[model samples]
Structure formats: C-alpha cells, structure tokens
Target: MARPLLRLLAASCALGAMAGSAAAQVADHGAPWLENPFPSTYVPLPRSDVMLRHATILDGAGNRIDDGDVLVRSGKIAAVGRALANPGGAREIDARGRWITPGVIDVHSHDGTYVLPLTTIDREAGDVSEGSDVNVADTWIETAVNPQDTAFSRALRNGVTTIQILPGSSPIFSGRAVTVKPIRATSVAAMKFPGAPYGFKMACGENPKENGAETHRGPTSRQGVVTYVRKAFMDAQQILRDQKGEDGKPGPRRGPPAGRGPDLKREALAGIMAGDLRLNMHCYRADDMATMLSVAKEFGFHITAFHHATEAYKMPAALREAGTCAAVWGDWWGYKMEALDAVRANAPMLDRAGVCVTMHSDSPGSGQRLTIEAAKAAGAGRRMGIVVPPERMIRWVTSNSAKVLGLEDRIGTLAPGYNADLVVWSGDPFSVYTKADLVFIDGAIAADRSAPPASPASDFELGRVAAVRP
Candidate 1:
C-alpha cells in the first residue's frame, strides 16, 4: 500500500465510534503501521508439477483447443500447448476424455457473510445487511465472514475456486466486498485472495429504498435514494479537496484540519475517488443504471460493474461506453418491479453491443451451479440467434467475472504465468450431466472425485455426517 493510502486508512480509523464491535477491533491505527489490519494469511496447499495431457481446453479467453496439454509448475501455469516437451519428474495425469478450463469465478456472492443454518442463534443467522443507516461504507463484509460456512465446500465441488463475497443489497452503501479463495481455513483472512483490490458495494432501486421505508426511516422513494448517494459523494469530494494543501505540497496544514478525527464514511468513499477501490453497484433497471452512470461522471469515479443488472440490455451502448461490466443472473427475473423488464437475452445483447458481460450468483445454490447458469444464458442467446459458443460463454463465469473483481490478469485465464487455478470436468462443462472431476487451486488439488474426501467439509457438515449415515 502507498503511504498516502495508509494515511487515509489511519485517518478513517480515527472515527469516534463504529456501528459494531468488529470495526472497534481495528479502529486504532498507531503511527508507522505498514500492514493491513485484516491481512491475508492464506498459504497455497502443497502441490507438485503436473502435466495434464490430451484434454479439450477452454482457456477462458475465447479460445478452445482439443488434444491439448497444460503444464503446472510451482503453483503457476508453466506452459499450455499441444505436444509440449515435459521436463521430467512431473506427475502426469491422463485426461484424454476430460475437459479442462479455468476455475469458475463467482463475482457476486453472499456465501460466508450470509452463512447457513438460518435460525435465531447468535451469528448463525449471519450478518447480512446492516439496516441501521443508509451508508455503511465504514463496514467491511469480511468481518462477518464465517469460514465454517458449508457453502464454500459446496462451491468447491462445483468447480468454483474464487468468489467475491459482497454485502447484501438492503442498504444504499452496503459495505466493502472481499474476494476469497474457497479453501478450508481457520480464519476469513486465511481465505483472502492475496493482492486483490477491495471493492465498494453500493445499491440502487427497490431493495435499499424499501428496507429504509420498512424501518420507518427516510429514502422511501427512488429520488431519495439517489439524493443520499449524491450527498455522500459530495461529502467525499470535500474530504479530497480538504486533503490538498494551498501550496499543492504535502502537509498537515490542509487535510482534515490537523487534529480532528477523520470521517470514516468519507474516507472510504474517497478510496473510490483515489482509484484504490473498485465500485460495484447493485442495479436492475435501465433508467436507474443510467442515472448511476451520470453520477459517476459527475464524481469522476468509474463504476466497475453493475451487479444484478437485469435490464442492462436496454442500454448496452451506455454500459460499453462507460467500460462498465453488466454482471447479471442467467434467467432470474420478475421477482420485483424493477426486475420485471429483464430478458433472457440480456447478456447476449450486451455482448452483441461490445459491452463487457458477466454472470453472477447472488445465492449459495446458484454459486454452486455457476457454469450451468452461464449455459442457461448462452442457451437463451442461441435461441435468439446470438450464437455465443462454449468458448466465449465460458468467460461469463471466468475471465469476464475476474475483470469485474479487477483480478483478470492472474486467476481468470489459463495463460502461461497465470495462477494454476483450473477444473477438469467429466464431460462438456456446460452439460447438465457433467460434473467437476477435479478442481485445482494454485496447482493444488482442492477437490477430486476419483479420490476419497472429494472436498473438505465444514465442521457443520462433519457433525451431520453421522445423521446422514445408517
């Protein structure tokens, strides 16, 4: 992290008090702090050099190769081609009948944060949405992440290796998003993706406004929601301006008036302005999305993606022009008024208009079956004569989604020098009958069907094992 960014975070920590105990834990940042408070403790599992040969490969960049080979060495892809010379002593896997592709990346998920075993038990119901206020920018979703969430194991079994866990859409500014690798770990930090940038989660449309209305607070209408967002950004802009010196040099003479505590909300919102945090907005209607684009222009910050953008097809050109990705569900629609205009060909239309299109799973079940969800969208495209092939459609769950998280260079594709995060399927990945035979994370076998213990189970699942057996 840069010194300026660190100072910004320290200033944010100076807020008088936070909503919950989680923020209070990391509230005090003494001088000379050089590390993140919630730093990653993830270590790659033991792995060995391996060569998978004669498999059909979709490299996650709109290319397919048959009878191909993938060489994994030191937890990174060493080579990818046909008939490549294998440096001896590498374990060889005969994958002649299998299909290999980049591991599935779910851009929008609430797996760990929402958690399982929905009950009245403390913390078991999960800390999803903090409805106390409209802007909870100071909060982070990872603080409530339960590493023991059984959903991680289920997602691993279905070939998902990386997931960007976001806060729920029940607040205008929900919280910050955390990207994690779905691996067995003791702490949420152990699953955090190293070097991944943080994402700010914001929302528009029915969910936020309705939640506030039900709580008997303000912002019951769409205009009120927009007003809240605009006012927050305006405050953030003031913070940035106040941080600069009159002489245009670094000094305590300008930023925050020397001794006063920093505004945590504006500090976090400033991160988006400083280009340090990616902005992900949950929006559904076309008009609402366009309104967000205009706000982005006014504030000089980019909207990285529009999650659950059901009506993005209606304004594909605007999304493409803004270079914002439309992360949508495959076929989910009609559940609410804003989502009623969704079409099955939403993704295909965006693709046709040269927009970056990706698919997302906002639920646990959909997270496990992400590939088939992409297939559903692609199938809908085919019916509309859009003709998205398997090679390109695979990107909806892989590379394009990676782009949404701003980690496309490392984990999304099967290119040389990329992380060896991939999956081998029993058959065509899009086929409903096919399943992930093996899944690898950073060259380590995370799941294997031919071997015992297909995937590591959470403690919750382990306790239930006896009940499932005779």
Candidate 2:
C-alpha cells in the first residue's frame, strides 16, 4: 500500500504541474470556480397565512407537543406552541385527531437520474452512471436529471419534500450530487434547492471494484479503490498548494496558462477540502468505512455520511468519533456478500452509542414510504429491549436526514423562522394506513388529500406517456 501510494504521489505531482496554473486561477477553493453555471431559478408558489390547530406535533428535533398549534406566515414558520395568537386573514384548519411533522427527507435517491420506464433503448432511460472514467468528479448529476420523472410526484404525495439525487456508485469518485425540491418543473434548476451545497459521491467495496474489473478500468480491488481516491485528492492538494507563491504569499492572478481551461475535476475535489461540498460515500462494511476515514483524515476533510452502511452497527464509536452519520435501510440484508451481516437493529444500536443515524431509501419505491421504513428499524429495536419513542423516531427521516444534506437549520424542523416544509398526517405517521393529509413546501400546499389534483403528476404522465388511443 505504501509503495503504490508513493508512486501515485509522484505521478499526480506531474499532472498537478500541468493543471496548477489553471487551478490557481480559482480564487476561493472550488466554490467560486465550480459555481452552478446553471443557478437555481426556484420560485415558491404563492401562499396565504395558515394556522393548523389541535394536532399532535413532532417538531423533527425530538419534541412532541400534543394539541399544538402551528402558524405559517409568508412561507416561514411563524410560531409553534400549545396555543397561538390567531392573526387576521389566516386560514385556520382544525387538524383534530391528526399528526404533524417535518416533511420526509430522503438523503439518497436516484429518481431523476435513473428514470422510470426502465429500458435501454431510450437515451434518457438511464443516465445514472458516467462509465468513461473512474473519477469523473467533473460531472454533475443535475445535468442528467430529467424533470419529467413521475417518481417525484409519488414521493411528494408520501410527504417527501427534499431529496439529494446522487450519481451511481460505479466509480470511486462518481460525480457531484444535486439536492432539489420535489416540484413539477420543466428543468432541474427550477427544482433546485437555493443555496444548498453540492455533494460529492464516492464508493468502496464491491460496486467500484466490479465495475472496474468488468470495464477493464479504474480499481479492480479494495486497496486499489483507496489508492485511486488518495491519488485524486493528492492531485487536488497539489493544485491548492500552487495558490501560494515561492515568497510564501498568495500567487499572482494569471488566469489559466495559455491553451488550458478550468480543471473542473480538481475544483470539485478541492471543494470537498474547502468545506464547500459535502462528502457522501457508499460503503457496506465496517473495515472499508474505517479505511475511508483514514483517507479523509489524511486529506483533512469530514465525510458527511455513509449510505447503505449495512455493517455500520459494528463500529458505532468510530462513527461518533468521526462525526459521520450512517444512512441505512431498515431490514435489508443477506442479498450480497458485503451486506450479508446487516441486522435490523443497525440504526437503534448506533443511536444508543451516540452516533448520528438516518434511514435512507435508495429505491424509488422506498422513497415514498420513508416514515414506515424508520418505524421498521425502531420496531426491531423495541423487540430487543431498545426503546425508541415516536418523537425521536421521526428524526431519522426528517432532521437527521436533513443534517446529512446540510439543510437541517432550514428545512427539517418546525421552528420559528424555518421553512414551513411539513406534512399533516391523517393519523399517526408510523401507521401504514395513515396518509399525508397535507404536504407543505415553503408554506405552500404542494399536496392535499381532500383537494383537487390530490396527487401531482408530471407533464409526461399527462401527455405523450398517457394513453394515446383513448
């Protein structure tokens, strides 16, 4: 391992020399250079003041208030309490016998990138993987996200308001992920969450190695994956180093050495080092996670979260020590060798050990019912003497998931001055029979059970994809 890293360091230094001039042109790490060329044009729907009264409220931060009242004014949560002053001109809904909680957030999803109507014939059927290289950090998943994916509406009806659309894990550094609001829009920028930091997608264990072996490229072994990742970051570090001159001062501004363009690859990687892009990794085993943590330490970056961490329960203390969250499934296990040791009590065990844990849905179907998924994990714990209350269980799908996306302060809690992105359930959120009575995004009704167009549909579902003969 040491010999390979030394050789890689030498090779990356040469590549860095060619890219240094162009890379140094970037003033602020990677944020300014990789600024969304296509910025978000998200415009919240026009909304009126709303006051929900007489409901069981789970504030998404481990607080439960019975018979509470919540006030939404001008797209923000104005107040939340057992009783609130009723302002004039606000629509009051007596939410008797209902429950309220922050809208469900799915930290890991492939809805738009890997569209439905699965077929290889269409060019847009699958845009999840960029197979050209093992480290295509220059690529952005938002570029391939199709706005007409019908899965968005299904998730919305189930109270999923925000999602991070990540790239496939076929490569060590797959690409950058885009977080977006689940809204009907003609373009991805329209649904993009304003001011949300980008996510860098990474993977270890079977997927990358298998893809490399099959494609005859990238890393074909576990150690190879770590080595390739280290090499890429090392090159990024070299580029960042060039920002300072021989006099130990900031380098003079000379935009991109003639004939060279911006190095988007290194810029994205450097973004992670600069705290601009959150790092989300796909690792199943405890050993692989530990190895990745060492790489993060060497590069001086914090991993935001680990997705599909099937064996994360084996090392709760390490995750807590590293401040990395584990985004896992409820009962998924034994399907693959890496996930063979997955136990139902993964989340509860980690929570008991003071590790931040969330229940994530990697599938389109599972994305719609994340609350039930969290309940599944909690129920498993209950069967084994680990008690999880409703107030705390709600965080796994709401605040905890929001923390993984770095949007906890804004979207995940029903607090004053926060975005009024929440759901009103007909009954207890944990019950399978109960449905989201109302779903609000930015204090506007995005989905309503008793209203017209109860479930939103995309243009594709209403036009070309609908029955033509009828």
Candidate 3:
C-alpha cells in the first residue's frame, strides 16, 4: 500500500478502459480553442478619436520617449512620436506633466475564478479537481469565473487592463486558463480576450502533493507527481498512435478497443504535444522545473512560461536558452519552505542573464498595484547595479507579460496597429505616490480620473470606486 502505487491504482480505476473509438476522437479534433465552440463575445466599448499631447511615453518596448504625443483613432493607436498629428475630430488632452505607458498586464491571476469571500466585498466549483482526482486538464476555468467578483474592478483601478484568470494550483494539471479583459460583463465569455490562445495549467511541487497525498487521492511525492504526468501524456500518445493514418476514424485500442466519445483529458495533453496550447507550469523549485522541461522534451512539447519561479535564478542559462519566461513576485517570499531561497533580485538577475522576466500578482490584493510591484523589482535591480529604467520595468507588466500568452503584437505596446490600451499616470509610474490618471482600452476611456468613475465602474463599485488622480 505505498502511496505511489495506490495513486496509480486509483488513476487506472478512474480513467480505465475507454473504447478505442473514444480515444481516437480525443486525439483527432484536439485543442478546442482552435475550433472554439464557446467563442468570445467581447467588443470594445464605444470610443472617439483621442489625442494626448506632451506626455512621457514608456513605449513598453524598452524605450522611453519624453514629451511625446500618442494618437488613438478607431480603437487603435494611429501614431506615436513627439507632436504626432492630432486627428481632426479627436478629443485632445493636455498631458503636460503625466506619464503614459501601455496598459499593465498580469499574466498570473485568480481573481474571477478564486473570488475572495471578503466580509466587506465578495469568489469555483469543481474546476480545479474532478472527483477529487488530480489531472483534470480538460476542465475550463472560464466556465467557473464569477464576473461579479469585485476583484476585477479593483484590478482595473490598479491599471490592470488585461489579466489571465487561472485555476487553482492544486492539481498537477489544473485544467485550462483563459485571458480576460478587465471589463464589466454578465459572462466570462464577454470578458474573454478574443483569439488569445488557451493556457494549460500544470503544477509541480507543494500544492498538488498536499491535495492528493494528504487526501489519499493521488501523487503523494514529487516523483509520484512526475510519474502521474508522464503516464497521462503517454496515454495521449497512445491515442495519437492509434488514430494516425486513419484520420477521423477510431484507432485500435490496446485492450479490446471499445469506448465512445472523445476523452477531453487526453485531448488537452495532445494539445500541449501539438503546440496548440501554451503550457504555464506552476513550479517554484528549479530541479522540478528541469524535470518538467525534460518531460516536455521527451513528449515533444514546449513550456510557455513558469509561474512563481523563485529558484529560476539558479538555472537562468537553461531557461534563457529555452525562451521560458519566469513569472515572479516583487518581495513576497520566505513564508514557506520552498520559497526560502527567494531573493529580491531574482527578476533582475534573470533579466541580466537574457531570460524573460515578468512580475505577477498571484493574489487579488496584489493584482491592483502591479506597477508598484514591478517597481519594487526594478529597485532591487538598481540596488544590484543592474540598470533598469521605468521603460524596461514597464515590460515586466506589459510587453513581457503579453509575450507570455503570445499576445505581444496586438496589446502591450503603444505602437501603430496595436490595441490602443494605454494608461496615463499622474506622475512617475515607479513612485509610490503615482496613480493612473486615465486608463484606456481599445482607444476608449475605460477609467478616467478627470471625471467621476464612468463606464469601467462595475455595478458592484458604482459609488465606492473613485478616480484617484490629482
């Protein structure tokens, strides 16, 4: 009755013996997001052409342009330069002392899905784990998101224009994650970032073991976790083998070949192998990440990003070469054993090594002030003699984050043909006293401090959420 053996026995019992036909279908039409049965219904709010002149623009491309003007027309950036031509009918704003940058993007967030049950404010079912069994990779976090959660509004006020809502990290494969626009809506579909690739959520250490081994459900150890993950992918591979050559038909099942319908769980794994889904693994330790990287290579898959990579500084050379972005925090660490190795200079250290670094707010409270979080990492870099200016630091929450989800070209930059999602700061964004004077998404005034809370204000925060600019 060893823990590992017991875990395998349970998995076999749960996913045991589906007919060959079901496995075939799973591998054939894999990656639901490509065909997207539930497509996004998001349309940018109505906006007029706008011209913001005399602003310091942190272009989100590691360049700073002072006293520049940005023009927005038709929900897209028309041009960016010093004294760009203002459209004839655009509303002009005198941003003489303000700083403008591409909107902040939080790559790792659980706001709408894991809504906090605040006594003052306001939080999924069954999405993180299925039947208390790990490896529920097929489930969708979007279906479980509560649009009414007040965190979205708070995140908006904090200048977060976009955030990816992730499932809890309790399972080794904690289902799928969806990127969302921080706008008020009745359904998660309305908030979905249109055409963004879905993210496959996987965890390596700590959370999964505590959930499975402690609960006697599955995977009691790190080795056991890897074993479980490998077997799942192998099962998907078997499906692929059977379905090959005879496209659209059922492949021969190993034992007796008799099952109906596609196995969503296996399809998700196949999506990863096929490179249709981006893998965002929640791994804190470097050794575990290395192991996961090996597993991915073995199965011919790629990791898009590593969440909470506190120990990534140790393996920067490999991570940089692999092109894996390390989504980290500012200074929140050392409260646990795995996090004891965390250093304030982790982000800069990794950046200096040519690795992609992004600052993430894993908590609802932290999601609001993400710029401040990135500033903390930048300050730590300065202390280490690694020169990081506001322009470069802005990428930790903007362009680099967009790159994590493969949405860099559209959002995350204030360039022509990109989404006109930019924020105007009352002062230097790195300072604690600065506030987002205006937040624009797709050229529309999403949050404007010039007036009282307007369109972006949710029903939940109509009276309480106010503009905070001088």
Best by TM-score: 2
Query: How much is 258 displaced in model 3, in angstroms?
Result: 5.4
**Per-candidate TM-score against the hidden true structure:** 0.90, 0.90, 0.87
Greater TM-score among 2 and 3 belongs to 2
Q: Name the runs in model 3 displaced over 4 angstroms.
A: 1-33, 118-131, 246-258, 454-470
* Tens digits of lDDT, candidate 3, 1-470: 12232233223322322433323433343223234556799989989999999999999998899999999999999999997776599999999999999999999988776655543332132232343568888788888888977888778876889999888788888888899999888998999998787887999998888888677888989999999999998887654443333543322333213674667788678667766678999999899899999888787777999999999999998898788899999988888778889888889888888899998998888898888888887788889899887888888899999999889999999899999999999999888999888999988888776676555545555445677998
lDDT of each: 0.84, 0.86, 0.80
**Candidate 3 CA-lDDT value:** 0.80
Write candidate 1's Cα lDDT for 286-353 as tens digits. Answer: 99999999988877778999999998999988998999999998899998899899998888888878
Clash pairs (backbone) in predicted model 3: 19-258, 19-259, 115-123
Q: Residues 300-339, candidate 2: write the lDDT tens digits.
A: 7789999999999999989999999999999989888999
The residue-level lDDT of candidate 1 at 163 comes to 95
- List where candidate 2 sits over 4 angstroms from the true fold: 1-34, 121-124, 245-260, 454-459, 462-470
Ranking by TM-score: 2, 1, 3
Task: State, as a TM-score between 0 and 1, how close model 3 is to the true structure.
Answer: 0.87
lDDT of model 2 at position 30: 20
Residue-pair clashes per prediction, in order, are 0, 0, 3
Runs in model 1 lying further than 4 Å from the true structure? 1-35, 120-124, 249-255, 454-456, 463-470
